[model samples]
Target: MECAFCTDGIDHCHGTLVVHPDGGFAECTDPGCADLDRIRHGLIIDCHAVDPGCGCVPHGSLGPALRRAS
Candidate 1:
C-alpha cells in the first residue's frame, strides 16, 4: 500500500516498499522518517543531546498537551 511513516497518506508516500529477510516489510526511503519510526519502536534511542532542536521528544500525548498549555 503506502508508507506507514507517511502521515500525509498515499498522496505523499514517496518511499518504496522494502521487504527484509525476516519477512518484515516497510516503505521507507526517507532517512528522517525511518529514524522516527525506529525511535518510536524503541529500536533506537532518541539522542536529545545530539538533536537538541528536535520537537518530537517522545512525550506521551497528555504530557505534551500539558506542557503546551503551560
Candidate 2:
C-alpha cells in the first residue's frame, strides 16, 4: 500500500522508521503531528510502515529509499 504521508508530499517518506500496527499507538506522539491516530490512517511520523520499499526498513539494514535520498 502507498503511504498518504508521502503521497501528500513527494519523497517525504524516505528514511523514515517502520512502525508496526499497534492499537495503543493512536497518541500521535510523533513530533509535529496532530490529534489523530496515524496507525488507523496507515501512517506514523518518520516511519514508513505503508511504504517499506523505501529506507524505512528494519534497523541496521541497507536503506534503499531511506532518508530523503541524500
Candidate 3:
C-alpha cells in the first residue's frame, strides 16, 4: 500500500501505527520518512491507521489472510 506520509510503496505486513498520549499518530517500521503525528483527537479511531491499500489486512481479516499466506 502507498504510505500516507511518503506516498511510497509499503507492505501492510511490515507496517505499524502508534498512537501517542498527545493525540498524535505515527507510522513506525517505515524507513526514511518521519513518523506521522496527529494534531487533533478523533482524527484516528481505535488506532485503526493501516488500511488494505497498504497491503495490510486488518486483525479482523487476519484469519483468512493468514490462512492464505500459509
TM-score of each: 0.23, 0.20, 0.24
Number of the top TM-score candidate:
3
Q: lDDT tens string, model 3, 1-70? A: 6545345443233333343234444454446435344331113323233343333324453222111111
Error of 2 at 52 (Å): 25
TM-score of model number 3: 0.24
Of 1 and 2, the candidate ahead on TM-score is 1
Sorted on lDDT, highest at the top, how do the candidates line up?
A: 2, 3, 1
The C-alpha lDDT values of all candidates are 0.31, 0.38, 0.35
What TM-score does prediction 2 earn? Answer: 0.20
Worst window of 10 by summed lDDT in candidate 3: 61-70
lDDT per residue for candidate 2 within 35-68, as digits (tens), equals 3532333333433334343342455343232232
Judge candidate 3 at residue 70 and give its lDDT. 16
Tens-digit lDDT track for model 1 on 1-70? 7556565543232333222223243334455454323323312222222224234344332211111100
Error of 3 at 57 (Å): 28
